[model samples]
Target: GGGGGGGGGGNTSHCAALTHIQDCLNLAFSTLDPISDRQNAPPAHTGYRVHIHMQRSFASNERTASSSSSSPSSYFVPTLSYWCFIPGMAFRRLSAYRLRSIILTSGTLSPLSTFARELYVPFPIRLENPHVIQNDQVWVGVVPVGPNGRRLCSKYDMRSDANYQDDLGNLVIHFSKTVPDGLLVFFPSYAVMAEIIDRWKTNAGSMASFAALRPSFSNSGDSNSHLSSLSTWDRISRNKFPVVEPRESSEFPAAIEEFRNRLGEGSKGNQERRDEGSNGPSSSSNGAVFFAVCRGKVSEGLDFSDRAGRAVIVTGIPFAMAKDSKVLLKKEVLDQEARTQQAQIVNCSNSNKGNNNSMSNSNNMSNSNNTNNNNNKNYHAGNHTHVTSPQPNSTSSSSSSSSS
Candidate 1:
């Protein structure tokens, strides 16, 4: 991603796009060549194919989009992607044949047919289980209209707006106080999260008060002061930047140890203290507020059970970056494949119907051969009869989805 005619021109504008492409290339080349080190090499039994493709990425400028006087402008970023392809048989060994059974699941698996074909599962027994949790356990709300009556949205166009940040920050502060323990707030990307955090810390005074309510794990529950109260986070942020001299290597681990001590969730000391009925400042204080990025490590397979997590706040739907070269190519390939398959299915259906019709005609012609001399002409005409090919389904274009 890069600034699209918004930021100052030249190097700064290209930085984001360059960084993304560089990271992608690094990953590709890391495994591209066979190394002498056994640990670094691909499995000996696996067969692999490498693909290189050039993709044009256009940066989406959110600030420009929100401006009524100016239209959104995009800057083209050329990217080269290296892809590694392992055939379905490789996956089949581990998932299909190797495993006793396989279960594929997701919260939004609507239009299940697409998944069936993509996963190569010929006949899938799709099960959409009814909600086990009560309706009250789940809460859904739309973004409110702005003071000027413009409908609020977290789309690319609106996210950078000052009004949007204020609205979102207010909501966060509200939920932080009203909601119970262990609230998980997810942002679309780290850049967005960092920007919001910076704004809240600098501009929004309410956020400071809200931050004070939660206990910090930077120290060993000894500090109760507001800024100091956000101890673990404070130390992490300090370490990340150079406002002050960085601490020794032991500081991070020590800070983490202090954090675990407060959570009473991980180490033996905290667990033991919890069993002893001592309401340590960490345990007795208000619960944790975990800020995470969508699709990050926290959102993967980890279960936040019991008191660990009470509620989750998703600021917006996390859509894949459209301008990313690899992303665009993958979507294009899937859509093309879907259309091809649909056309093939239609052609096969037409062929089968035509064959049945010709068989019937041949039978009738044989019967009429004994009576009419023109029966041969009729048979030849029936043999020469053609059926127009079926057009590809119109809906296939929109039905394709990103590969899992």
Candidate 2:
């Protein structure tokens, strides 16, 4: 997460590395007596071992690479070829211009490369190693696909969480079309990764919220088993953040409207459904969990077993990725201190025109937007009627939505 040279002087890295080692040793001593630690060593310690040998070995190499530079110039994502790289590929250039896009500098999408090499590839074709091999095949085969869907999108968007936020402020569909149940994760932004929570608050406390529902999907690579999170295909959804601030009493109409809309939907449908909770006497079997996430907070680090107990609705995209890499870099430092691998996704998501390439992604949604007379005129409807068919399972978005 630390930009460019990774938090300055070589001393910093060495100190951090030593501190990490010390902490690990201390934790080992404190958690288990030496006698028991040895017995459990194979699973707990050995299992978590990584051959940072390469990373260590590369220190001098990296230093040499950094100092050996023949030219005085700038380096960006494409040059490092980190975020722009596919899982596997033989890198051919190290200059910034050679990178994928002019925008990116770091993130989950960045490629791990040997700055020591002329090209970013390994010193030799050690692609036989499983991680290397897989990465190579992906780079050679899949990476070339628009330099790979992940790298391309990541390089460009900056903040591209797949979670789909809904019109309702508080409810967002993590994986569209798949309605969830009980205390939902209100990602707002992973609920899109920005915190549309404010949007939810505005909706929850505003004067005009009509049957609002928000939804989203998380791309932290979490599996459903851990917390019943949705997969791109398994068709479930995931994660959480925080809650919404309840509205002032003046928000009654909006709350009432939301209530009326719920009643209308529940009553107009199946028989016993009228009593399905929110409105009538019984709650619908199809329920949702509500999670509230605040921008610029520890939303991602904490895990809630009840992740999506109900269903999450989003307010708006949460916080735009920070302008510089400071916050993300600090997070990386903290995660490392605790011997954890937290995802640090950097994004440039403040663009006004969000990418709208997949409006039809969801199967459940029949309508995309609620057309008013002014808006509908463009669609030739002549009258201001609402279009209600939303795409089902449309969990991802480019996030061009306003809190409205």
Candidate 3:
């Protein structure tokens, strides 16, 4: 198969489909055996360019149990998507026909130039509207180091470590105090979130420390209360003391109601202060804190406006795990493709500047290296400071909307 990682998993149907696609492609290629070679072709510079990308790394699919399927290991279907674009094709087709207007809109197409290229929209015009929220209302901050001054990272290897979890819990507690009302915390994945929560619950001291910050609720969708899940009933369990739990039935609704009340109360207080010519920020006591995983139900189509979503705290960069086999395969393929394209560009650029002296070429190469290094640094810095939107169709910033 072209992108063969999906074969190992327990998905027999997907494996068969992949095999069929590969066979069909092989037959088609055999028929076109005398096709012209475009090995040295310019990268989308002239005419049309067909780009193929493997979709297995980040594609969404259900995990099949090995016991229920033919394959022993669970694997994802490694599919290939092709983008064939010809410059000016849109204009040529439009000129050949009668058309009034062709307006395109998309929420995901933030960086318009990339979308334009992929869609072959030659000479495209783009416009964007301002985000809904104002700058001063939202705040975006980057906490590179934790309260202990250690690097705040959540990579697969370090995320499960005791020290890392402690630091993460400490950071969450610290942020909870500063952020008012309902503060939504988004984790990279559900597995990571569950691990951290389980560790804290198992450790009484850690649970006490975390509880002191705020009443943290999770969008786990598990209807059973945390205490109910316990098989044993001790004296402490019957004490009617409130405990933070990751379930809907366990104080989640009550927390939300309390948060709403606090919002109303806070608004009245702020109004009174403003009426008295005091421009100080108001504080509230009845608000709640919520924890959710990225791409979870709460993070997607939920409305967390006003007091429901005063702040959003992202634990770490939500990149895919590097240790996964699919991720490794994707990295290798992308790195190889990038190296080939970069080499072609470098060769073409150098050939175009053949008249330049050796010293000039060396200087140009040095400048390129420096630029690449700087770009890498900037990317790493930006990735660490990444934060999700607290509400749908809303953007966050401390000073300006673009600051986020």
Candidate 1 vs candidate 2, TM-score winner: 1
Candidate 3: stretches off by over 4 Å: 1-108, 120-123, 130-132, 144-151, 174-178, 207-285, 321-404
Rank by TM-score, highest first. Answer: 1, 3, 2
Give the alpha carbon lDDT tens digit for every residue of 1-404 in model 1.
36754566666759977998888766555444432123443341222333454443434432211112222234555444344332333334345345656776777677777656544435446777777778987676665653233355778777777667654655554455555545667778655665555554445233243344433312233333444234222332332211110022333344333334434554744666667777553444355556666776556666777545666777767897788655665666557556856987999999999999999899888877854554223322333542223236743222222333
Q: Summing lDDT over every window of 10 consecutive residues in candidate 2, give the lowest-scoring window.
A: 80-89
lDDT string for model 2 (124-154, tens) is 3222222323553322121211101222122
Best by lDDT: 3
**Backbone clashes under 3 angstroms, per model:** 2, 93, 1
- Per-residue error for 352 in candidate 1, Å, reads 3.3
Estimate the TM-score for candidate 2: 0.20
Residue pairs with backbone overlap in model 1: 218-231, 218-232
Report RMSD for candidate 1: 19.8
lDDT score, candidate 2, position 289: 32
Task: Tell me the tens digit of each residue's lDDT in model 3 across 1-404.
Answer: 63575655547787888999998666444432211233543333232223444443321342211112221222455455422233333444454465665677755667877556534444356887778779987778888876655577877778888767765665665555555656677778755776665554444343333333323421133233442343211112221111222223343454444444444434565575576566543443435556666866566666788666777878876777667544565456446557866998999899767857776989999999986675444222442543332344765432222344
lDDT of predicted model 3: 0.52
